[model samples]
Target: MKESEKHISHFDIVVIGGGASGMMAAGTAAARGKRVCIVEKNNELGKKLKITGGGRCNITNATYDIHALLSMYGKAHKFLYTPFSLFGVNDTFRFFEERGLPLVVEAGNRAFPHTHNAHDVFRVLEKYCIDNGVVVMLDAPVERMVMCRTKARIDAIETSKGSITARAYIFATGGASHPETGSTGDAFHWLKDMGHTVTPPSPNIVPLRTAESWVHTLSGVSVDSMKITFLVDGVKKFHKTGKILFTHFGLSGPLILNSAHTIADMLHEGVVTASVDVVPHLAHGDLDKHIQEIFSEHKNKNFKNVAEYIAPHGMAVSLMMMPGMPLSDTKVHSITKEERKHIVHTLKDMRCTITGLMGMDKAVVSDGGVPLGDIDLKTMRSRLVDNLYITGDLLHINRPSGGYSLQLCWTTGWIAGSCAE
Candidate 1:
């Protein structure tokens, strides 16, 4: 053995990458009276979890129906049934709420801790590990897995700290997204070397950049109820309704993030664009009548003075100031009938060209990991390597934002921890 490899430490289970799944798996194993150690590259764990949902931490989507929740994962739904059936969303709620971190459901059935502090969620997992006697090795970046080729199992792993030998190993190193949080694609390469088919990852759930500077000025503004339609060369492709948030670069929020993948595909075909209807529920006649009432209410007022009443909250300035929009100096009563119709049209069809999606750096979740065919999702164990298991973003599953990603971590981690023999 080499000098570093000679310093071997033994454990009943060794979990790599102390983000969401690794921490869960280590704590679960330790609770079962196994000697467990969690290795993390970062000085602290849960860097990504800490900032998820803007630090409020959307713990899981409260979709109680197993079939309904699984559908969100796209193609991997079939592979996931076994794991989730064993440790499903209800189990997730029981696990945390019993431990004193109660979760509350909000719009879209998205769940968060009542405190809404992500750090508290991390603390719950951390406390689980500490109470169960799991050893944590922070800042110990793993170099490579030492595989027993003939036995088809991981014999040990080389890390900056030293070599670690475990009866079973769980890899939860996450996929490439938010690299600043330490979820780099190091494990994907290692799995490829082991002959696993690692899919090349791309930013899946991310924000879109737009061509309009007017959109940029509305940064930090969000429309609670709106509809956005995507098109290619002026032909409608698809549309979704919910909420949309404007960023300095473009558009975001749950609605936009979920649409990014499809929009990305559309971008490849031709020039992609979008039309935002600020008041989707209002028909043309209804909206026009509403605007007429607002105009009559302030008959002598300048257009800009009453723009806020017609436009979405906090967006009147930017929308009214658009190049072709009615001049702010124009009196509301003097506004031409054609201009009145134009205003209604603009509200219904707020046009903007989609430039592109933000890269991996801004991605909430990236798809690409070992295909489900190579995983026994029943136990999250590798089909080829008997004693090796995979969890979290390491498994190729395409899911939208909101709480699906973290729920995957919890479900897979629990099953792997329970079944790792």
Candidate 2:
């Protein structure tokens, strides 16, 4: 038969969305003697996965304790106990290592393939699927479903090419983010139509925008150690300390992306702002003393030079331009005590008002999906649809950007594959 004329029918299991979780699930099921097939809308698998962490693919964290790993999932931590315990971080290491793809743990306990190529990670999984006898159909977008008489279960799925039937179906279609990678949230609408309560999808772990011109001036400046406080109407809501990268629009990096949620929420009521402490480890008094010493050491030098030594040159320049700030050209020896205090304040409390969040195209991971109650956390099977399993970003588990998202994909995909009859 011609490739387009091929109609795969009556498989033991059928998996949708050939991304990380979908590929993992299909490969896992086929490994255990199940006749499995993966239906991917895109021509290639793992498009988004290939680009994660800029193509390095942080597979999981070195945090081996199940509790610690689960904690990264936040409120959904409890829901993941079963899947994670089944195939947690260590097991992930073993899974990849056994496949001859070793992982290395970098700073922050993030584990990436030793090759540091995300395509390498996907290559292994793709080979696993191919070697295990799993059928892969690319460009087969699921159009709609064929539900059973009860209207409470999915009997089969009708795709763009043809209809597929299976004893079990795994929907690992990911989420709405990165639609360019083919995760356009087809399952969300499909699941919601089937009575599942899907939480509204929003861009998560995305960069923030700012109205402050100073932020734009410091566009490529990055502070290795800094604290960011999210405030609404000048009242602090929350804060975190980490590295931050100033962008033309606003902020990016671990410090800003993780806090974007609080900023998103605070946008409703007041002016959302971010107050950055470039030297969070240093106290006000200590910083002043330190600045005083630096000024004395470079008494005749331009303040700009000293400021650049204290912080990034761009930030120093921007700080000097802030309202009522002394000129960057001022000599350090001529700096007044009040001017010293102003410098300290600017160093400790660089402020920017958030304008908005970047759109879904830039989201590292989306914040919403099918709520947990709709599926059994123990098995990743639908409570409403008995023969159906869901995994990955399809679940409404919000987590910070790290290896946590991919780990969730690994665990849930493996479990869904293992448990699917």
Candidate 3:
């Protein structure tokens, strides 16, 4: 049989990329009695969704105030007003709860499956698609879109397997980050060819790589709470405070991942540095007094041994090893006034030179995709292309982690699915 003729099917709606948004869109459309087909390049569905929140898919934020939720999106918050109003976070909670999937809230109002299994979330979404009669075509990567000369609508989709003609098409190919999850920014180029404006993708929630090799020695080390200040050309640019992790490559965890976008941009222009405050809650005077107390209590102990109480064990050792700082073997009581001041400073602000980002593969999510101007906010239908809807990371919206990104998927996917003609 010819490759072109071996796999061809028709549907009322065809959704590309079977991640969070595509699956939701396909399921919703199919539930409305539309013959929906999902085209996914991966062998399985929701490859990315299966790995979110370290494999415990954060479904949505527990923040119920619409205003507060919107503010979390920053500038893109305005564009989400209509979509989220239709299917806000509360609606998201209900959608899953009604489907027999209970969610639990964490420290930051992040809602995850009660079972804490991302695979469970994917299972539910896949089951939703099946229950609604949506046909999924896996390993069917799209090649191009067939467009009409006189109309702003897709006629057919040219794919790696064959061509699929649909009355309505939804592109949810996602952003360029985590290419291993099959999000290679394919739709950005395809949409550009279809005359839609696309924002070039950049690593948004990526980790930072430090120039210091000592950072690698601190691998697997984590601070429950700390503050990091981004400095360009030796001047402060911005700061973030939260859980921080030291990796073999550099700094990561919640704080560094969220700050990578700005840091990446700054690194492109000039030398970027970071000052990590291990104890931001303590004032200089208070920290000095605290250190004095610790020294007095451990006067006979090595300085390194006493420093452990002030910072992570790895951090304490690193501080003592810093140039001109006190020796690790020095007794806590023997440390001079100058050394005491240095110890205080190190506890407050340990510095590092940030060389670059940890690469897109290590990024939690990427920012920028198809700009919002190309799609109608109310319906999610493309203004430039009729019979076409865009949803999820495929659209250029910079969102932070902690359920904001997945919420975008649920809101836009529902809108695109419900409003598609």
Candidate 2 Cα outliers beyond 4 Å, as residue runs = 1-8, 300-302, 331-333
Model 1, which residues run further than 4 Å from truth?
Answer: 1-6
Residue lDDT tens for model 1, 282-348: 9999999999999999999999999999999998988786656779988999998889998899899
Pick out the ten consecutive residues of candidate 3 with the lowest summed lDDT: 312-321
lDDT of 1 at 69: 94
Error of 1 at 64 (Å): 1.7
Per-residue lDDT of candidate 2, residues 190-260 (tens digit): 89888899898999989999898888888998878888888889888888888888888888998788877
How do these models rank on lDDT, best leading? 1, 2, 3
RMSD value for candidate 3: 1.7
What's the TM-score of each model vs. the native? 0.95, 0.93, 0.95
- Angstrom error of the Cα, residue 81, model 2: value is 1.3
Off by over 4 Å in 3: 1-7
Candidate 3, lDDT over the whole model: 0.87
Clashing pairs in 1: none
Cα RMSD for candidates in order:
1.8, 2.5, 1.7
Count of backbone clashes, every candidate in sequence? 0, 0, 1
Candidate 2 accuracy as lDDT: 0.87
